[model samples]
Target chain A: MSTPTHEMWTARLRGAWQRNLPIEKLLPDDQPAYVVSWIYVFGVATIAALGVIIASGVVLAFQGPAWYHTSDIGNFTNSMHFWSVQMFFAFMVIHLWGKFWMAAWRGNRVRTWITGAVAFVVSIATAFTGYLVQTNFDSQWISFEAKDGFNSMGVGAWFTVTNLGQMLLLHVAFLPLILGVLTLVHVLMVRRRGVVPPIDAVPGNMEVHK
Target chain B: MTGWLASFLDHPATYLKWGWFQISISNLIVILIMLALFAAAILIKFPKGRE
Candidate 1:
């Protein structure tokens, strides 16, 4: 007499899920009272900005750079993508710095910090590839200027930004795919860790006596 | 005033060079904005013992 394989696997998954993210922690409507500070809001704002950025970028991806640079509707979507990236970077930088100052890695939350840092670094690469694929004077100049430095480091052959086709594929596909994965990991870690409390916050102190 | 600040922040021609580092006005603006945001977040406090 043996347990069914399906049941065994299901039981293991259930155990892991329970150990990692119990339902109450995952969907708590009530937050700890110290969570009242406005700084906590920046993380949500950053996530929102990234959502818009990816949405606009996807729309832009359906059209080539020439179309976006020339046609009205394409131009509108391009502007949306441009501004969304700007907002994304702005919000992300603020959130990253805020978390750093808060020492957000406290109480075994180190994975959260590392994931966020990974997301930030990947975002820089994605943004640089984005600029290179812009099909404008700025892109040409940047590619030309950057090539020499890359050549000095002996990476120019692999990452030649001057090659529009290669750059477009990287900007539209590879880098964004990596960014999406990094963001997913970052979000899952945040969910698992819950939010970090302030430096002096007592573990079981539910409320502050005002 | 708005135009002046915009120009000050985005004067791409205004470049500064150091040992192996080069930056323009727009880059400076970004750095300043990030620092200001960081400082502002740090200055905001939660209630005592609330962490």
Candidate 2:
């Protein structure tokens, strides 16, 4: 006899956890030797850049645009935020390119690949909103320039860059929250699936339950 | 440290005086950053053969 829906769902969840996320898999000391490659570094570097971006962003959010643009500490924090965002995109693109060439979607890891792509798109939107909230010549100039693109796409009014409050809200709250959640899900999927096996190792070698 | 590094990325000039338009340091910074990222990506390499 089949169990009730709730009970069956609970059992399935437990089974999934045990099979995919045993303690060792979630926090592993031993990864496959194939992971000993410099290409892998970019993924971790991207995450590190994101940490800096979030930290500096929180500092900027605490102090308003006036303070951030004028005060020394605020300027420093804002620059940190800016440069970290540079690093974030740099590393993310490299990681994305490396994974793409490796065909990272293979080995039953399509969700992992899709989640990463979603996170990338969300992050780009977050960065675009950041540009709009800078409260400088850049913001005004970009707002006007960006207007043409959005107007062409029929989203000019919906995403008006000149709407400072709207831009700020999306930058400091909505976009970051969405990016953060997507990133977390991407990492969780990575942990669940483990890194995809090296292309050479996939042919005849036994697949380790890493 | 991030601030220190960003100092090197300081505005090279105030504005670019063009025939029809003036491009400010902010605009220039975006271009410079993209160039820097492209350069950095080229410099950081993965090994040619599989490990």
For candidate 2, give the DockQ.
0.15
Q: Write the per-residue lDDT of candidate 2 for residues A24-142, one digit (tens) a residue.
A: 87887666656656777788899999999998898888887899988889888998999999889978987887788789999789998998999999898899989998999999999
Residue pair clashes in candidate 1: A198-B51
TM-score of every prediction relative to native: 0.82, 0.76
In the range B1-51, model 1's lDDT, one tens digit per residue, is 267877765654687889899898667988888777767766777554423
Please give me the total number of clashing residue pairs in predicted model 2: 0
**What lDDT, from 0 to 1, does candidate 1 have?**
0.81
* Per-residue lDDT of candidate 1, residues A156-176 (tens digit): 899887898998888778888
After superposition, which runs of candidate 1 have C-alpha atoms over 4 Å from their true positions?
A1-3, A6-10, A208-210, B1-12, B16-23, B42-51
Q: Each candidate's iRMS in angstroms?
A: 5.2, 6.9
